[model samples]
Target: MAVIENVHERVLSAPAPAVGRLIDRLGSDGDPLWPSPTWVPMRFDRPLGAGAVGGHGPVRYRVTAYEPGRRVEFTFDPKIGLRGTHTFELLERGPESCLLRHRLVATPVGAMRLLWPALIRSCHDTVLEHLLDNAERVVTGTVSRPVRYPLRARLAVAVESVRLRAVPVPEQAALLHAALPRPDLADAFSVRVPPGVSADPQAWADGIFRNPPPVVAALLRLRNALVTPLGIERGDSSAFDTVARTDREVLLGVDAAHLDFRADVLVEPDEDGTTVTLSTHATVRSRAGRAYLAVVRLFHPPVVKAMLRRAARVAVAPPGPGARPEVAVAHG
Candidate 1:
């Protein structure tokens, strides 16, 4: 038995699972031309049943029913503010294409429902378009280009091993600090923190003693060479994605183990030149993952400062688009 039923689905040339995930994830941000109200770093909460907020701070309910890479239903609750669910499902047609359906049903408190459905719909479509465009780009090989390499680093990988010398300290830190969100690390994809918890240090201290400590974040650093021999971009996370066995480790940031990580590269132009930083962090299970960051607390100020400087040096690279700047260690 269905209440208010509205059906909307799109069929793509892409596989069903892929279309489902891409569509479901694009909820408030599916339309390419419009800005998504649920951008990852800024807006949008997963687990549709999760409550969202209005501009000021009114609770919204979202209930998501999804089957990965298939279909998604995002239902918004009016009792709360912009509450809704996002679901995804994939139906394999043959070997190539699939059907993708994404729905958003909102229960607007009495009158507000009529106020903003169109605006919400616009944002949703934009994100969906972006997903298709990105998928096309990848399939067409317009993305995933190789990095610019130095004759030395390039030759060493393509030919022989190059001797390692000094560690580039200042350069690595700057790169990490830029890639990693130093100030708002806790603001990442967060689980609903019950009705009474908070983001304060004192609250955190009390939380640990009184109840269970939710996963905060795992802080870490990594370094590697991506010479032709390694067939990788220097310190690229793509380098590890091809691994066969995924390591199993508890989320407490204690023991170091093998992991699959991606490095986000962000370049900022300055009066001097350009600064590039690689965003690196732990990708443990969401629950245990938060505990994994406990290890970062061990770093002293001097150590932290040193790391930042190293990343900075890496971030501020040399001039010239074709030129491969001096090789420096890339830290997380």
Candidate 2:
């Protein structure tokens, strides 16, 4: 096996003490610093210190060394193909400045050997950049240069992105009213109920809206994770407060706080099936908003697509064997 190391550094405007507090907060439960939405939120079993086990998602590690207001190191257990130590250090630069550095030294074996160079490395780079930006923001009150997803990442987002699903309009308008996913959230909702379930659109819509589809809930979690860091407001029912719902279509608007723009989701029946299209038509009011939107646009489609697929699974699924007739829901 060969050694792999990545080092990222940033000069913060604040003193070492303030910067250190931010670093120490990483991995602790409820830590204010949120990583990029693409990565799992950092978590730990106990306080952030020596011997405390922590990592993001399935990546587990133990704090091997700790120095309050100075440095900390995490040594990850070997799993699949990764074994390494990641260290963070604060170096006082001046009376009101400090240099924060993160270093990852690891050896990748087995499948990880190829995976590291192929995928993890790129994502790690982006995450590290985001981590640095977040650290500086706590003390500087702004991130002058936000990180953007690389082209490779953007391409991946495009490849797996979900599009509209073709759900046949129920024979009765009431069927559509009932089967539709909740429109309260500024997200795309699609579902096809089994024949046994009430086909009335109103009934389906009422029940669906009462308890958001699992996929929509999961999507909201990711949405919150991404927008909270940027200080953007997440969409709620107010997104549709101004829209009009008709027997054939539902028109709603969505706003992204701090970004100074609005998006709309158009739910209408096409000749083939119902089509839900999410479109943003507002001019970005600020430079910062434009930059932020540019970065997030790549992620938006994939999120919508995933929700559609999930909705398809839930809406068309049989309650029991031969409980009801299955309907064909195709992705458009």
Give the alpha carbon lDDT tens digit for every residue of 89-158 in model 1.
5567776766554454444444445434534333344434433334444333332322233443333222
TM-scores of the models, in the order given:
0.30, 0.51
Candidate 1: residue 182 lDDT (0-100)? 38
Best by TM-score: 2
- Candidate 2 segments whose C-alpha is farther than 4 A from its true place: 154-332
Report the lDDT of model 1 for residue 123.
34
lDDT at position 185, candidate 1: 25
Candidate 1: misplaced stretches above 4 Å? 1-9, 17-64, 77-86, 135-332
The 10-residue segment of model 2 with minimum total lDDT is 318-327
